[model samples]
Target chain A: MSKQIKGREIHLKSRPQGEPTPGNFELVEVTVPEPAEGQLLVRNLFMSVDPYMRGRMNDVKSYVPPFKLGEALDGGAVGQVVRSRAPGFQEGDFVTSSGGWREYHVADARQYMKVDPNVGSLSAYLGVLGMPGMTAYVGLLDLGKPVAGETVFVSGAAGAVGGLVGQIAKIQGCRVVGSAGSPEKVKHLREDLGFDDAFNYKDGPVADALARTCPEGIDVYFDNVGGEHLEASIGKMKNYGRIVLCGAISQYNATAPTPGPRNLTLAVGKRLTLQGFIVSDQRHQHRRPDFLRDVGGWLREKKVKEVETVVEGLDKAPEAFIGLLRGHNTGKMVVKLASGPA
Target chain B: MSKQIKGREIHLKSRPQGEPTPGNFELVEVTVPEPAEGQLLVRNLFMSVDPYMRGRMNDVKSYVPPFKLGEALDGGAVGQVVRSRAPGFQEGDFVTSSGGWREYHVADARQYMKVDPNVGSLSAYLGVLGMPGMTAYVGLLDLGKPVAGETVFVSGAAGAVGGLVGQIAKIQGCRVVGSAGSPEKVKHLREDLGFDDAFNYKDGPVADALARTCPEGIDVYFDNVGGEHLEASIGKMKNYGRIVLCGAISQYNATAPTPGPRNLTLAVGKRLTLQGFIVSDQRHQHRRPDFLRDVGGWLREKKVKEVETVVEGLDKAPEAFIGLLRGHNTGKMVVKLASGPA
Candidate 1:
């Protein structure tokens, strides 16, 4: 026990008032705890920062429980097992687990899934081959159900989950249109990601951009940013269009009740289906095999590209998360707690 | 041809800018043209006026085509066949057909269904046994999918489709709650229609009314009046709730677009499904046999009660339709075009 080291963690210092600020997070030091029977101790290499975490900072009830003040905030992270007291796991093996925002976490052997470096990069396990990837996979294929000739529209198109959605739709032989916050992000969508069309929503009204891009109307909409983006997509939706309500980053910071899309009534006349979902609810569907098999092959073949905004140091997670909410990141935003194995 | 009589019809005089006025309709006398070969001439006994007609009054695109200016509005009607050139239909037979804003209509014999008056009343064919009835059946059973003991909330609960929705839900063993415009409508929903609870939304905020009525939360919400009713229903929805988007009469008359339910983002966390459909889409899924057998049995056994607000004369149809949009009627609003044979 005396040979154990010390580690640091980011805690939820205080709940935010509208939008979060630096004051909401606290960094504290703690002794690295030993792995119990059937548990393993791991050193986190990378931890994800996402828009959904913003909801957890609030004291209200939500799909995920609120982050408690004075306690470490937990989320998705990739780590290497340093010590094992469990079956089928050994030292130096990389695994993905939740309860991250910390340098070290003692997890039950089954809490993390062992990752294969031969399959993909270690960090890719936290982004493309992980939760975000699965979300895009299930939400698009199961709910959006885009056909080969259909036109699909996605808000937050250059984002973690959304980027994969657009790419998957393209692979499925659909024409894709994307909306992003910056011109560079838009360029990434078109020139890099091969979207049929892309628009910078910040430059103009979303409805106008959608009209110009989706002249034939949208058959499916993958919604990550809500509010105006959602409304515009609905306005341009064709008969029997499908909307996958995955996230709504646009309304997360709203102090007052945000207005919903005005044109939702179009659903009735168009016979549209708007389905809202949380990725965790569908985890039992065992879509990981398809995600890794398809996405891993695409990664190796360079058919799919991974975009990331990496902020160095564990202390930088708060800034990365806040930046993500502001659409400052072009893709998956992660805080690097430690460097890769030398 | 010698016994043929003249009939007057109401035409769409002009597209209404906002709310429809009497000037929007033009009543004119037209000669009773003789039925051609394989056609039937019928004297309309009763005709229906529904909220969806308001959309037709506009010159914009919708699920149904816009009513052409100077052309008679067409909708559900029941009549007695006066003459027939077809084999199936006979003189004095009762039938139901579309294209009914006139006192008498000439139609291909196949265009109308020869309806038996033994199952239900002739007017019930225009409401509880006709299009509105089918809408209630499909939207609730097919989309809403309520289970036994679940709480189902219905808006515009005393209206034609909504009334049948509550009764059908009750028969399915659900705890039904309803909201209506008037105290009398609410009383009828509770005392006569057997709703578990009822509220007059005209008396207070819809959110408060829903909270009071649905203390345990709503499982299935059949949305009729879209604005606040839809918003309030979303707030009280349970996990995996299903919302049947039936109508949005509250927003139909607005010159500008109406705001959707702001809390719709709750769908992500609650995993709610909000599906909008036109009754016509599910028509091929003919529920007619089930409707006639079950609803007829309910009517005969006195488990269900039917209500109608009758306006005498086809000349008064414009007012009847206008009043329906204003929530001026309880249950089905029908216009008496003529009386049947003595």
Candidate 2:
């Protein structure tokens, strides 16, 4: 017999023209969904706020579908499996899934991955041990193809993906440099993240900063914030350099057509390759085990440090998400719905 | 013994402000001397006038060196080895080398490749079997990676590199479409070169032309004239489409920065990979045999057609070279030296 329970849900009220305001989101009380055949009912502990979500907020066709108005927005989340009707999942197990911005979600059990609590914190699975970590690993290693002694430049260095990218590049014996928005974030990148150098992008011209840090030229550039950062990286790229376009947080909320570097002619002169990627396209299932093992080892060894802005209560998620867009959060931005055992 | 021979040489008198004028070139009488210890005396037969040479005429740093004023402008050419002190070359041997705008010159034997008459015409080596042919083969196959049944769009369809790219893409079982400046070139692309469809780019807006021809979004865009054509291709490209940037002939002589498509944001939305390449970087000695064999077979089977505007005499070389920049020539534009046998 299915049990009915009350759940807190956040729905899209309206599409934002530029920067999303509170009016765009609606918090509502709803009956928790019951698991159908081969489904699992989960109680979410933490929800992820990502830059890529901005693309979904707009009514535009992209790699992923746009978020519908008056519907619950869905993304990566860590939860406890309260009930299960599938072979793989059982009650009381910790898991992660593309669950809605809700206290409880009923999803196909196959979509939810069981997490090992002994390895790390359950929230860490939503950030470093999850999709964001895999995105950084495959995008840089497979596409960027960093060789030893190469200079790797990463934008949004303090974010979940960028922060891990710098650390991974360092493990590969690359001279890793990064750019973040604030001095505090830059300090974290240099001190804790093991970046060879870090710069505050807001301080001065990015090209000048790149010149000072990367005297030779950048061999690979992992672009998280596009527009001017892409232009600056283009100017300072070595011959045959590869640019991994992970995200463009800089232009996500731009009301007008974003003004970008018009000097794409440099791509020809420099013999550069600029590739845009969606993490889902990378075939995560086959790679997930290896990724978990590798990144898990790095975390345990303290080679890769992770920082998170843990927003308490699901009610504060929209503000935390907005804060992420404004570069106010360091590392992974995750909203906590419950007080943990600690 | 050092012997002197009379030859006609064209010198860069001044750099052109916009479109290079005939006044910029000064034809002068020069003494062609004998080969040094490791050099060969080559009697230039047919010289190529390619778009990439335009970049070398300017003082700006490029893949190759800038053209020096009062010195003979150099480009790829088919010639006959008259004398050789180097072990690799011999007298009366047909070869391809970077022969300057001159009747006869002493070249390093190491710099020239011996052309086989059994493969194709000696002049074909200057266009189809040499740099331009390799450019199409490597750039399209390596960068574009056209799969069977994919739609491929090419700009500058009648030019040396573009013409070959369309045919090569077709050979790979791709549905190939191209854009040319004239009706004759358009006809050549469709009727002679085996392109699935072709259009006159000068007739109307490229986006409109692309929309009409490419109902299925472009899988690969081989860009030779990158201005409006590049922008149009960007709009038509499918998800994960590959853009092989071979050259930007349209923007070479641009006085002001050519205002490119402001909608480069489409790159992220479509997840396009835009790459630029120079053929020399990908070339290795081992690849030449296979390249010549495959491209040579296509030439002999008449699956591919080679066309050229053979301007008579070295004195006409500068005019032909300038004509190439203005899109005055069809296919490969070549200057025939008076001192060589036809």
Candidate 3:
């Protein structure tokens, strides 16, 4: 009976050269999967549209495998376990998995993690309480190594990872500054995110803006946009500074090879350490319990605020993802698959 | 009586656009000066010819000041004190100072370090026990962070810094490979430096050589020639490899802006860390004591051997430096200003 139910799915139609086109995706109806031995049948409540998914579309070798043409696209998703063949999970349990961009998914019990709806909103598990939040926490604290009274600058400040990085650095007693593409995003960063200063990189030279905001010099630079942001950050870095290369959104859609800063020689004179890291490489894996505990407390105490943009349906996921690449979203972007209670 | 003695000096006549010429240097004569308060009058013995001096010739912002035309060129030198006015140092003592390209120099006593005659040869202090040695030790161990059983590659294998770096990595239980310009240097790297493998970079494509030599993939890369050597190293680096950007000898003479490698995006995929460092900025200041203690012990124990090209007179200093920039010398290049005790 479950196999007869139809599910909406999105599959990769072609590889993108620069910005992805709508034609690169194919929306189709497929038979909904039934729970097999040790598996759970999930009704997806919310699906995540993230920047990292862009790399999967390319054929180049990366940390993650490239998404193959004619295969369903997969990313983080919040869902409800409608039926379970595994002992660990039961019917009506809220869960999350590396689920496809679809209305329903079936996976082994081990792949789906139980989500506590009582803790917060279900979408929060896909953003602030999930991978993006963890990336910001680990990348800034562990790799960036910001100290008290130091000036910490973050690029892509309106995005999921950047927004959390700014707040976390501020909580660690650093004077935080951020950069975004528009005036509205800059306003959100300064007014809502508690960033000490914010700037629109689209308006003027980022290096000049950095020089004006960080008079003393930047101690730790958490870079989300690599190309020009990396160059500008290199110029304003103080002696013995640290730069964390977490993401490179600026170069994702670049049609040609991105020309990096010619003044990278400054790294020697400044005694700078420019490290490129992925959150999965962080040392404290078993410490996540403590992380979620502390971050959860901080959220309740109003120390760190969460910001997100919700697109109404799974049908709009490709559009939302494309908008994310163009800096159209204010914060974490998620696709709402179901209305209210799971 | 000191004022009556004539000193031979080499002055910078003009800046060179590419390869330096004899016209770029002027050999002049000046009267030797008497020792003043807290100063020592020294008869120079050996002066070092290093690749870093090439940067000083250009009118660009760097770690050190540029060589001003019409002024005498200065560098690391070993000398015998002829007269002294400060406490602790005395006449006939062998010492090292920021001695200029001259037969005689008046140096502040505080600027000179007393050398132990028991520590092999005085010229060793100008190479293995000096800045180049410290640079190799700190940059490889601290920044490159080569672990035992890892593969390490060093460019400019015949030069002072690269030779020492390869040997030190070997001592740390790493498999060391090196790239040099000539067959003789390659032979020297393999036979004399005890490198696991060595190649002549001028023979073929460096990336192919690297791929052939480093099958397990390079974990640490000590970069001395940045352009093509850096590009090759990046291609063969393993996940989480570390690259120490010690110098870029290839681009120092480049008239136009050097175009960076097209595959620079590999840094993000491999999660590699590329850091530029001047040995002077090392966080661990005790490297001097540690280096002298360890390298001095190694010399006595016959664990490491050093080679040097000793030029005849102070008049030849400028030519020797020019030759060094052109890769004319193997091992450490130094100038002998006066006859030794023999």
Candidate 4:
């Protein structure tokens, strides 16, 4: 006999014009169906609310499809496989999947990746030991190619991926400088994250701050916030610099098309290379094991830290996401689901 | 005893605020110095007037030094050795040197490169076989990296470097499309240059023209004209496309800071790469012999054609340069100096 469970889920009520609002989301109670032939039912413990989620609220053909209107929103989440009909899975297995924005999910067993809690905490699997961690590893090492003694300038350095990028750069023996929206985040980047230098972009012009903080021009720039920050980075880049275009959280919510960096002409004279990427691309996915080995070791050694801002419930995911876009959270923002037995 | 010679040279009367004018130049007659112990005297045959020269007039730190006021301007030119005091050089040898905007030059023998007249025309040494040709060869092959059956889009395709880029892309088995300023240049690009499609950008919006011309979207974009054209190219680029930033003739004369492509955010989802270079960089210069072998063979086999707008007399050099910036000439713009014995 199958046991029916009632769970809370968040759906996209409507699409936002620019910046999202809580009204655009709806939380409702739903019946969790029994696991079909090759499927399993999951009890989500923690779900991610990220800056990239803002793009999904708009109707456009992107690397990932837009969130469907009037349906449950989905993203990275850690859950317990409470029921299983698939051969490779069993009841009470800890797993991670794109079954977020909900308390319980019913999906194919293939959708979930089994995580060993002995390796790290459940929330760490969503933050440092997960997608954001992998993004930092692939972006800084594979793309940025930072070598020892090279200076790396990271924007949004207090955020999930940016924070890890600075720490990883330090591990690579690089001189790391970062910019964040607030003084507190800047302080956190310097004091907690171990960035060589940090600045509040809101305090003064990014160009002036960059010049002052990074006396020698940047050899690599990790761009998480685009627009004026990107322009300023280009101005401060040394010859043959590499720019990793990881995210443009600053322009994601703009109602109009934002103008790019005007000083791109400098790229010609300086022979710079600017490249963009999506973390899920197969080329990057191949590096996941190596990412785990390196970042996992660092975490265990306490050389790298995992920072998170936890919201109380699934009903608060929309506000958390909106806050993420507004730079409200200092690091990875996650919504905590019901605290229950595994 | 050394023979004295009177020669005419062009001097920078003043730096221009925006678009350069003929008033900024002054042509003067001066005595050509006799060959020193290790120097040589040469009579100039032809000189190059390129879009890059505009940057040197702005009095800013760049890849090349700015043109000093009230001094003879120097650039790429082919000349005949009239007198020599160095062992390697002989009288009547054709050489290429930075002796442009003058009738004669006196410099150390090491400052010139001996060019074989049998390989190409004396003027060709200043155009197809010289700096412009090397730029297209290195930028397209190294940076763009077009594979067979890919589509390559080129802006300012009727100009010196761009024209070679389209032809070289075709040589690499790519479908080539181009954009030019005038209808006549468009016709020349399609009918004479063997481009698959060509559009006059002045006809309408660059976005509409690009969408219509690049039906399958672009795999490679050789950007010679920046601003709107660059913006349009980014909109039409396929996933993992490459953009080679060569020149920005469109923005060189802008009195104010020109805004960049507004769609750079698309680069992230599409995984685009935008790289810029200078041909004179030692790394690119290392490819010179390979460039000559391939492009020189193409020239001999008639697979590639070198187009030039020949401006007669050194007096017309200033006007020709101004016109070069305004898109008044198709292909390479070069000034033919006095016609004399080699």
Q: For residue B67, give model 3's deviation from the true position in Å.
A: 4.1
Clashing pairs in 2: none
Worst 10 residues of 1 chain B by lDDT: B280-289
- What digit string (tens of lDDT, one per residue) describes model 3 on residues B70-126? 988888988888888999988889988888588888878999989997886888888
Report the lDDT tens digits of candidate 4 across residue range B161-255.
99999999999999999999998999999999999999999999999998999988999999999999999999999999999999999999888
- When just chain B is superposed on the true chain B, each candidate scores a TM-score of 0.97, 0.96, 0.97, 0.98
Stretches of model 4 off by over 4 angstroms after superposition? A340-342
Between prediction 2 and prediction 3, which has the larger lDDT?
2
- Across B1-342, the per-residue lDDT of candidate 1 in tens digits comes to 566577899999999888899999999999888898899998899999999999988888898899999988999999998888889888999999996899888989889998889978899999988888888988999899999999999999999999999999999999999999998899999998999999999898999998898999999999998999999999999999999999999999999988878898999999899999988775435777887788888989887777889999999999999999999999999999888842
Query: Residue B238's C-alpha lDDT in candidate 2?
Result: 97
Q: Candidate 3, clashing residue pairs?
A: none
Name the lDDT of candidate 2: 0.87
Write model 3 residue lDDT over A3-90, tens digit each, in one string. 3667888899999889998889888888887778999888899999888899899987889999989978999999998889999898
Candidate 3 has a TM-score of 0.94
Error (Å) of candidate 3 at residue B17 is 4.1
**What are the RMSDs of all candidates, in order?**
1.7, 2.1, 2.4, 1.3
Q: TM-scores of all models?
A: 0.97, 0.96, 0.94, 0.98
Candidate structures ordered by lDDT, highest first = 4, 1, 2, 3
Per-model tally of clashing residue pairs: 0, 0, 0, 0
Docking class of 4: high
lDDT of 2 by residue, B39-78 (tens): 9888888888888878888888877889999899888888
Q: Which pairs clash in model 4? A: none
